[model samples]
Target: MPKTALLTDLQRLVRAYGVLAGTCDHERAIVGPISREWIASEVEQSVLLSSLPAELFDTQRGKDLLAAELYSDRNVDPRSIDPDTLDLSELCRDRVINSNRIPKLEPQINCAVLVANMLLGVRLYGNHGAGVPEISHDLIVAAMLQDALEKPYVFSALSSAEYEIVDADYIKTWFGPNVAMLSYQIRDALLAFETSSDSVVSSARIANSLAAIFASRLRLTARAAGDSVVSFLGTVRRAEVVKKGLDPDSSFPERPYLARDFELAEAALQLAGVDHYALREPVENTLMIAVKDALEDETKRSRLSGRRGKAVHELHINLPVMEYYVASESSNSLETVHLASFEMMRSLEKGRRKSLSTMVAHAFRISAFAERVLGDALEPLVITLAMLHDVVEDGSAAVTGFDHSLQKIMFRFGAPIAAMVSELTDSSVKTAGAHKARMTYEQPHLISPEDQYNVNRFTELDLRPSDGRQPYTLSGIVIKLLDTVVSLEEGIRDPELMTDWWRHSGARIFWADNMRGSIVHPLIERLVIELKQSRSDPEYALKPHRVNRGRLRAGRALLETTLNHLDMYTTQNLAILSDEYQLDESQREFLIRSFNDPNITEERFSKLVLDELLTEDRLCRAMDLGRVPAKNYVTLYKKSSVPEESSDKTTLLSYRGNALRRKAIRTELGLDTPEGITALSLRHEQVLSMYDQKMSSTELKLPCDTVEMVS
Candidate 1:
């Protein structure tokens, strides 16, 4: 209803009630005592009165009400006001209505008015009155309060016991016994409607049921009271309730202003024969067509089933060549290689549908890396071992116990291949537990490993197999090293997946450290270094040393690329910058100045960029992860605190210098090679320029002649 129309109707009703009572005072329309007495005994001051115009305040009365509450007497039993005292002359008219037949009218009306006003307040503002209006119109307040003078209406989600007390007996004393009885009947009927099997049919069905019940109850109650005005008022109010029950957004009786707007908008759309769904269909169809086109593109295709077929074809094609090499170099028969390859395909076929091809490819790649890098002595053994490496952990071959699976492999591929495969497999890996604990949603870097694991579990790196469980066979270790390199390359190909893998493996902190421990073992390191020393003395220099050195160099390059993308803390503090990262005093000053420069700091960098480039030096020093070295300036600070000054060495500055010298030597060698020198030199020059941009002039000029390539 429009506000003006609603006000007019409300004023007409109040005037009719006033005429019937032989009283027409507008101020008297306020139902209760205006003094402090109407408030509860616990209320020190009436919030309603205080919020009203200041002219309404009486200093003495306000003070008394604040100090000693209006209803301070707790034991007082309220007395009912006589109908005659209200000057309700119409009640005395025998022909008009029977006063004795009427239920408690005054208090019932008062309670209804109070309820309506409270509902209005909740509708206009939120429950906490966060958006209360600056001025409330008198007619609006009066209209809301007058809604209470009719039959009781409730929209309760209360339990039966409490409903009985509040809606029945307690209300009986205030609104009179007859009104209370009527309220009980209404409450029971509504509660029954809410729980009935029919009510569960559908929302529209339930709403129809509620509307029928309310309409019938109102009609019966109005007839019983013998008042057309009462029936009229009941119809209006009950319609509001039924309207609300039909649709929450459309039925906002509390927010009448917004409710009118919603009604008008819906009506306008209805008249125009337009709907939101109709408007959205064309846009939705267009978007779906675009998506279909994008997905249908051949270049974007990635079918796991297709890849599985390709893997099978590639495995068959590569087998004859592998068999030839095995027959020529090793004592192992060609039949053994065939049996192992067959077993590998068979083992991977029953694995996870998506990962089957990937695993087969991994086996092929690992074997190839061993051949290209580790030489003929280890080649056949590593190939056979790598093919069956994951079988005991992932294949149906693994359904049997670990030792039983190894025995099966030994019977098929012989004890040597079986032993190396056993070493490659991680026996302690709890597949079910790890899968269940995996974080499948959100970016992994946002969650710390500490949130996902206990201290013992946190130290474990799933990517690098646990070192404690090994006989450290040379072939097995070399295969595993090649495995790490392949895995790192695959991970770096997709940065997001790489981050998730690091987080899932709990290797963000210990990635390089764990690889150093597993791939570059003491025996391997000593052999490689000694072999390099005796390269000119061919009598002592073993071919395996050159292979091991190549493997070490590949591993180092992979680690460097991993470090470039991983979440290693870089400090911005001047002390840490100069001390740990090896920025000289001048470089440190330049960094500090650049950061403070308004052009760089204000215009170029956002909050996210600044946060990305640097971590607090204090936080880096406070880390306590076991076996993970502290690389921040705190270590430098600790050294400075020592009694005597120890010379600083092994900083990032020296590392960059060495890296530049190596790059220069590699570039020079590429130029010296006669295989298309033009293209190679261009590529080499691009790399040299990159190095120059990354290093200081002094570091770039470091004697490249001293850095020799060990053949």
Candidate 2:
């Protein structure tokens, strides 16, 4: 057979050996305390033995000799065995038969035996050095026995007097000084790789460690970032080692090798391919490339290649050289987040209005917050949902294409994930309203009808049940709150977007209310403070004075109507004021005074209510009253605390109130002259000119009024 065909067959055998070993380990754990005879019988009946090629074994006499040597004693002394005289197939059979005899030492024993077999096979067919400058009988024996020599206690723990500690002296006596020295080097390299805090290490140590870990996880489970390091370790030549005069016991030189061993190891993974995205840490693109190269299916290989190319384009990353850089930069661990990020970039890449970088940052922030809140309970699910919350809504139709995209997601991922994405996606007003209704149902006393109307648009789902029951899962609601918090944070960072942010402030209130008793309440409280700071900034206030004034006027009208409808201010109404409205004692007192004052003008009373009494929290509370039953019974009366005041005192109070009202109006009209009259006049003229230009540029039809002339 060709060397390539031989190596391919060896890779297949090694993978089968790994899976068989892993199955034995699992069975030992579950079945409990079986005898070594049973383990040997189980190995004899397994497919691993049946699949061994006849060419690997010697003649029948050689097999009889090997069987007699192995079956003579349960524990074979290492020093008595000669590597040159042993047949490869017989040795593999002996290892497989005795692999699970020691329950506590099974994994390590299996790992060592499999790795040694892999190295020997790669050396024979792939023409690669195992780890040393050349392949030899002693090298093969040392690779197989390295783990036993390193951990002598495990071998001693076998049946009484069955095995002894296989130490360095025993190895040297059996395989000579060169194999003993090589085994020591392998052990030291493994220790350095596993124990060293420094990430940068010699390529030889990395290769050895990768082989060891890969052998250990033969079940093809997900690997961590540190363990998934797949780099090319070129073959070490005897001439190069001799020319360098390198110490045999020290670290190997930093240089490229033939990489035949790495190729063999990758081929061993062809059956159960690596899930590059399913790993818990961000894996390098080399890992993905390695998996792709190992795959025999052309379609799978091309599909993976195409997706990577698309990701490279969408992320605007230069491929080939910078793929590892991009992979290292990603903090997301879940495969869904990675896909969602790519989809988001693809959808938003055309307009580039919203920064893709910012969106990525938001996704990370939301996922992190969700992970923290959900903890280990629903961490994976919550983070996946949170990261994908905006993909369908914000995605461009031409790119993601709505239903087609969702169907693809469903097919690629599972149905539960696609369903959650659907729940999170606000694809239509009806869906948005359903989300609003769900949130409103969580806390009926906290959300306003206007917010419900604005969010839902229809009156059908507006009514909150009298029982205040929430019927939805917590994951969707938690993601909504987290998404809102991240958005509000973005708005807070950029002052220009604050105006647009406040337009959705009602939704924020609703979110906070719904999350009142949940784990995300603290986040809501923090966001509330941030919102106040942004709202109260004098600069922000000045930027949108007209819009602010209009909102204030509308609020004042609602407050007056609410006050007029109150028949009596019962204790229940007071409780509602304190709990739902969140009004302080002083604001409530002032509101009562302003409502009952017969002498105060309606306009002045409304101004007092707007400026002194009704804060945003109180306004949200007042908005909720239209749905609450307590609002229909509340009444206003003159406070007994208001004593008869002298005319001079009353006049002084009147003057102060008038001045305060005048200043409020000036601030609302942007006439306080912060930058002096000249700049203000220039700004006013610029605004009027822009308005006139806009009006004259567009043709408008005006209504003509005809009046009969009296003359």
Candidate 3:
């Protein structure tokens, strides 16, 4: 609602137009309050509308004897209030900021909303009138891309479609399907290479790989600045991480680095509007050789190769890297961006090194740390996938082509990393709108959980053979969730907003929208939220779990995120059955004779599997008593919160439903988990064994619980 000041301003403007008296007459006479209620209503509205909040309204406070405040014995003080300054007509209309529904849509869906907004708000919903441009395919595509890239800024600052309409005109039509003209641009870029190291890529073949993919994305995102692109690529080349002649050096200038770079430039032009396939090898190989020969590596040439695949992706911006660099004049804004990003990643600062040689080393270390943590709760290959999650964003990518950056990251890590990188690098994930990105990312196909578990998803991007028996495994499910958790933990700002965005999109797959209503949320949401808050804002001081600020309370706050009882039951119940059925050392001797019979269900085998996770007996009862120990500190407490004791607690009795979760979990672990799921558990030797074999989710879980013997 507009503040009373806004309404007052509107009315003041009306009065300035000599309509105040006229409006007053119209209100008192023809539109006169017919009933006592009507008169009372308008009078009360006049009074309430007069009071505006602080963010709005400036000076001058008086009714000026314009509209008299009438009281209706109707108790006006603590009730509904009317907007004073704004016109009643505009009051009911939705504000542009909150009017749109892009948050609820996927990339395809929200693009329509953006287009519509441009058509309406830009075209006719503006002060000047008819600002909308003629709709064209190129216009749609560019607008869609712009929506993805600048959506956060747009939603935050500009609301009128006209703002985008104005910006769209400057989208630089230099590189699209129109190629004949881009030849000049290419020639211009090639010219930059002629003079120095800019022309030649330095180092092992990886340089060539970086150059190749970068050229590809560059050609696709022709808007990239040639100079910035050169600098960024040059940065990678100068790092000297690879071996051989491919390294960057003064001798083999960037310009003469093989005919393939020029060829790739052409290929990029051909593949414009061709959704995927960002990187191809033959072209990459040529570029690698050229860049390699240009290198000045003091050491032996690297055995590492450039990323290999037919996968293509696109990225463009106002930086100096691509053909058209966008140097927004406000140098201050750029610093703010850097500052924000730096602050958001402060969680990683603790592990950083003081020396120069160890920066990348530190990154690898953190990656290893995340890997180890997830490994404990999940399978091994999946941990690698998680590590590769941030490799692309780490600044090594030169963006030579579509998905060039991601390809470079994959290449840097090798095949296993490449596979996981493939799954994590979705064009859908890089949305202009934060919520749009969330929607696409949360899609069942794109990602499983929140971004908090990014490393979890990275390892599982590719396929490994599934175990023949059961559908899914906990490791598989956890990876997806882990991927989500990592993303959310790092980039997301508002937890409430994050949850809302998740609900809007994740609802289809997750069913229960709010975290408080789910099993997983109760188990993990607090940690994620605390981590996110602590990292996002400097003021938020996060403490280890045992050190929570307050003492235990009655009906205390549990977890902001809670999974549904049914889902929890299914996952826990199945795990319990597997636990009891798989490991019976006493039955080992009998197993030789009973080899003819398969593993029996717990109920049929004279053993009952009770879930340690569920609260029925001692442990659960203690937990119910609010005397559970904190996860990080192991400190015990009581009376955490005495809920008014609602009838909400349900005993896990005769009920079952995990067919879908199991299906998704298994599919993810076998195919998506990196290195493939041969085994499950945190034990090092066992983990190494699992990494070597491709086991079905059931086979992995079989030994995990049901089968305890060697032969």
Candidate 1 structure quality by residue, lDDT tens digits, 518-551? 2332323333333344444564435432334454
- Which stretches of candidate 3 lie above 4 Å from their native place? 1-207, 219-281, 284-372, 375-380, 383-474, 487-492, 495-711
What Cα-based lDDT does every candidate model obtain?
A: 0.31, 0.34, 0.25
Candidate 3 lDDT at 344 equals 15
Q: Which candidate do you rate higher for lDDT, 2 or 3? A: 2
Give the top-scoring candidate (lDDT). Answer: 2
lDDT of 3 by residue, 1-711 (tens): 111222221121111111111111111110111222221111100112222222111111111111112323444431134335536334423211110000000111111212222222222212233232332223323322321221221111112232332122222221133221222333333344333323543221222222333343322211111111111121222232123233333332223332334444434323322111222333334333333332334121111111221111112111111112111221112222221122112111111111111112222222322332332222223333433443343322111111224444433333433444443433332221222223333332222222323334544444322211112222233333444432222112111111111211122122222221232332232233333444465654442322122211100111111121223222322322222233333332232112112243324322232332222344334334433321111111112323332211111211212223332333432322433323211222322222223212222111111111111
TM-score of 3: 0.21
Candidate 2, residues 1-711: lDDT per residue as tens digits?
Answer: 111222222222222222222222222211123332222222211122212334212322123323433645555433344545755555555332211110111222234433443333333323221223343444444454444553323112212234344467755543456656766766665465445423333443234334533433321211111111111111222222344442222221211111222333343222222222211011233343433343333222212211233112212232111222222122223323333444443332211111111233455456544433332233345555654566655452322222235554444444445555665555434334344444544441223222222322222232221112332333454565666544434322221111111212222232222322132333232223323444576665554212244333332322222121121211112223333344665665555455444567766865676445543445346547632122212112111212232111232233234334433434444445656446534533433333234323322211111111110
lDDT, residue 315, candidate 2: 20
Model 1 regions lying over 4 Å from their true place: 1-331, 350-357, 374-378, 396-404, 427-471, 498-509, 515-517, 521-524, 536-613, 616-711
The 10-residue segment of model 3 with minimum total lDDT is 98-107
Candidate 1 TM-score over all chains jointly = 0.29
